[model samples]
Target: MFVARSIAADHKDLIHDVSYDFHGRRMATCSSDQSIKVWDKGDNGEWNCTASWKTHSGSVWRVTWAHPEFGQVLASCSFDRTAIVWEEIVGESNDKQRGQSHWIKRTTLVDSRTSVTDVKFAPKHMGLMLTTCSADGVVRIYEAPDVMNLSQWSLQHEISSKLSCSCISWNPSSSRAHAPMIAVGSDDSNVTYGGKVQIYEYNEVTRKYAKAETLMTVTDAVHDIAFAPNLGRSFHVLAIATKDVRIFKLVPLRKDSSSSAPTKFEVQVLAQFDSHNSQVWRVSWNITSTILASSGDDGCVRLWKANYMDNWKCTGILKGDGSPVYGSSGQPGALSGVLGSAAAQSALNGATGR
Candidate 1:
């Protein structure tokens, strides 16, 4: 079971996204107000606003933290058609800070002509790589050849999905047996495309990313998508938010040495839930990939987990103010943070990650 907690996020406009740092000790939020706020957990377990500043000219759509190994770095995308990297400096002041902690803009990514919808940093194992998707259906990947030089980034590759993209997630598997993979979801209203989610894999032969698989069954407009941490599993698990909350497991099929084809997957729908009875906006997985939390138009956050038989079902529901909603899915349970540094799982802004 799970419980909810409320935060007084003081944004002038609609809050769009919240992301927790690697250690779960810090949280960052972005909004249509075009500003980002950083909160630090105190010794008493309460979160305090550490820094808040305007980072973009237009509405900020999403914000994500790079792995702690890369330093205190953040990437945010905006409707202004740019994605920017921000780095925290200890001595600088933002004027609103209680201390001298502040964040400085490192670089601005200006490749997208349309609103940049989502931005994500690659897995810690992938070096300092970043990916951003735009409303024009284009995905751009950038790499910082030198992690110390955050201002200099090389646009490594650009891929066009041909469908207006909404979100993108990198597969965080450290296993060398598989090539780097990324899943992209589209929010295009037209269902004629047949499939709204596409998985791409890096091709060493061509030194580029190639389409590996398409989740043809998901025909609706997808608002969010996430790849669960592999955790030594032979297959990959993905959670998606559309009209429903769905989970799929993709097991790789052995490849023939002579064939020049990419790896194929045996796709299976592990679970699907329309509990919200309306459009689901965002989905997120716990650090262990065992539990998933989703938010929808009903203004509630629901948690899903698998039983011993591997049957995924609702484990809890969090209503407004972090209270456990009285329902079949929720019992009078104890309060718990999904992750030690869990951000909003969110209802106000939108859930993205743990």
Candidate 2:
């Protein structure tokens, strides 16, 4: 029942997003401070910072690791109005002339003019496609790293009618089970008081995109959305963050004998809960899909569990480990002492086999 002490409180500004690689051996975090930090889990079960790099001129909003085969690749976006791909290069040959140990850079792909709020690599086809949402109210799809040049990539298409997409999530089995479906939600606006949520389908036959004909709109601005990660055993479900967190089962469109074409599938709201006082900012589910974690502007992290009825009920809240507070809120300070204390504590615990 204890919260793991793995992440460090290193960001000066608020952390917007965090992601773990497929193997769960490495993790990355992006913050409003305009930087991305990488952490590696050691054999002793401690999370240690392996590298930190400035990836944007403005606040970096989100970061996601590529999955499937290209495990080490990362995609990040920022308020500076750009999205970049970062991959950890192994050898000294790939490093800059400065002889840096690890090298990272901007991938030449779908760069945006307005702030890029979120970017995610499709889980099934890691190197094939990446999807991004921005303040410009667009959801654009771009090809992943090009095999030939590696540096050059192109934007294949864009969806331009969204109203400031707050977040997006792609179905993991979209390539095989489903057909590359993405659910996106917008910020609350006066026109749509309930907010807007749209599910898009990628047509392999025509190589075009279309909105799911029937059951894909919501009444509230989506704060954050996530497709269930563990796909095979269970039905495809999407968890969304808003005034109240909602979980929906996405039933794929089935063609009836009378109707030649597939109909818009129906969505069943599984559970609803109002857990945060302020706007909920992020939602993450583990591979089990039984446990859910959410964070918001209230500066608290809460954990929830799914019941037999598919209802999400709060399980517990994670409290800080009472590590020493370092600096005054008004003054800038170094994070060395705080980091050292945490690392030493972890090392000591590991040594004692606690």
Candidate 3:
């Protein structure tokens, strides 16, 4: 279930992406208007725009936030073939009140010859690392040699893909036992070459990234992909948005003592849903990874959950400004077809983390 909340009509073009901060108290939205806006949640549970500025010359594709420990840092990628890192600095005020925070450009990554589609910061334990995917069919990882300095970055590794890359997600867990993992999705509509979704793992022995698995079942162009937050589960869960919403369970292979082979992983489809009826553009998982929110071209956002028996079903749906339109899988006490306001509020509260 979802309630209607509107941002001011400041953007001149379509908004491309929205991302929440690590604590869910703030959100950043980017648009084709070449601008970005930051919103903060108030004590009354309403979101208010705090800052809005133009950050790029071309259309901004995506915006991502670093961990709060990094002191209010953000990264944005644009169609200008460059990615910029911005840091927030508190301004000096003559009055006895605190002044507004000013954002300054720290670094510009200009390695991509084409448009940069996505940018993601590595986990906090990785020490100021970032990964960017481009329309040039390349994925580059950059690291800051010193965490205190934000302007200097060293390109660590570059991997070439067969098709244009659209989005990427990094595994958030910092377990040293398992190699760092990332998932990349391709937006190429051509089906002849079979470029859809690929997973890469950091090979510590070779000091580079290697392709670990390719999802063959997803033949269509993938719009977004996300790896769920691991909660001591034996297998990892991944969600992909294409023409439909597909969930997969990834299992890591055990180390072989006899042959000394490298570690590998296998993926199996856990569930698929076509309720959107159109191209699904975005998919996001809650903090617990129990519920998933999906937005599509159908102008609706739907929430899905799995029962105790592992059967996935639609829990709630939200259309335009009206109340949440419950489906047949709604709770037992809910109305046969429609859910009451109290029930919808309770359901939506559980879906969103604070």
Best by lDDT: 1
lDDT digits (tens) for residues 1-354 of candidate 3: 234555563778877877778877777878888998887879987877777789999999889999988889999999999999998777643432342346778999999999999999998888889999998889999998987899999999998877899989998767766678888999887876564898888876677788888888888988888888777777788999889999998898887433323457777888999988988877887767877777676666676778899988887676534455655665321122233221222222221100
Candidate 2 lDDT over residue span 73-175, tens digit each: 7888877888888777767464444433374674844467787877888765545678898878888898745543436667877887457776788877733
Question: Where is the poorest 10-residue window by lDDT in model 2?
Answer: 345-354
- How would the candidate models be sorted by TM-score, starting from the highest? 1, 3, 2
Per-residue lDDT over 114-145 for candidate 1, one digit per residue giving the tens place of the 0 to 100 score: 99999999999989999999999999999999
User: Which pairs clash (backbone N, Cα, C closer than 3 Å) in model 1?
Assistant: 4-322, 24-341
Query: What are the C-alpha RMSDs, in order, of all predicted structures?
Result: 2.6, 8.8, 5.3
How far in Å is the alpha carbon of 242 misplaced in model 1?
0.3
TM-score of each: 0.94, 0.80, 0.88
Which scores greater on lDDT, model 1 or model 3?
1
Give the Å shift of residue 109 in candidate 1: 0.5
Error of 3 at 327 (Å): 3.7
Flag clash pairs in model 3. Answer: none
